[model samples]
Target: MKIDFEKIAEEHIEGFKGGEGRLDTRNYVDDRARIMYSTLRPGPKSGKHPHAGSFEVMYVVSGELTVHYDGSEEIIKMGQVHYCPNGHQHWFENKTDHDVIYFAVVPTLG
Candidate 1:
């Protein structure tokens, strides 16, 4: 079957916000691969958190976010992709005027 990405976005990812930890799964194939999107409010932080199994890949679709990772920080802007490897803890904040939006592939426990 074919997929309609636009309709999927409206149905799965619309009205998402940060600080609320909204993670909507658009599509999942084989239970191992998935697509998800998130939206963040201005000046919103993800709080101090750690990934027990860190193997996440993300792409910033719009706005900007400062990621606090491994004792340092980096500003991830639009059209940029970032990877969070294993054992690395990170938190992110929206440091821009507009809302921050991003998509990622996260591996979940079976």
Candidate 2:
């Protein structure tokens, strides 16, 4: 079906996944997946962690995000997508002066 993010309330998170700083997120979660709209201020990071039972895919809406995963780093800009496979470690950082806006989805596994 359709999910309207505007109807979702924002959740302000600090040190998400054990990282530094805060992020604004609106999320919808079900038994199978978690879909979220997220924004990170400059100089903030999503803590590095491993996805043990799911794969996460993030789509950049605007600005830039530096993604670290599987011993590598990638810069994802607007219109780009990054995916971290299940059982992999990953994190994201916003290093620019602008806010990093993105949509991320994680699908749960059995």
Q: After superposition on all CA atoms, what RMSD does each candidate show versus the true structure?
A: 4.4, 0.7
lDDT of 2: 0.94
Model 2 C-alpha lDDT per residue in residues 1-110, reported as the tens digit of each score: 99999999999999999999999999999999999999999998988999998999999999999999998999999999999988899999998999999999998899
How do the residues 1-110 of candidate 1 rate in per-residue lDDT, one tens digit apiece?
Answer: 55544556433333333233433345434455556666676755765556655466778989887888878998899999777776677777777778878887767544
- What's model 2's TM-score? 0.97
TM-score of each: 0.68, 0.97
Which pairs clash in model 1? none
Candidate 1 Cα outliers beyond 4 Å, as residue runs = 1-34
Q: Rate the local accuracy (lDDT) of all candidates.
A: 0.66, 0.94
| Model 2 lDDT-worst window of ten | 83-92
Using lDDT as the measure, which candidate wins?
Answer: 2
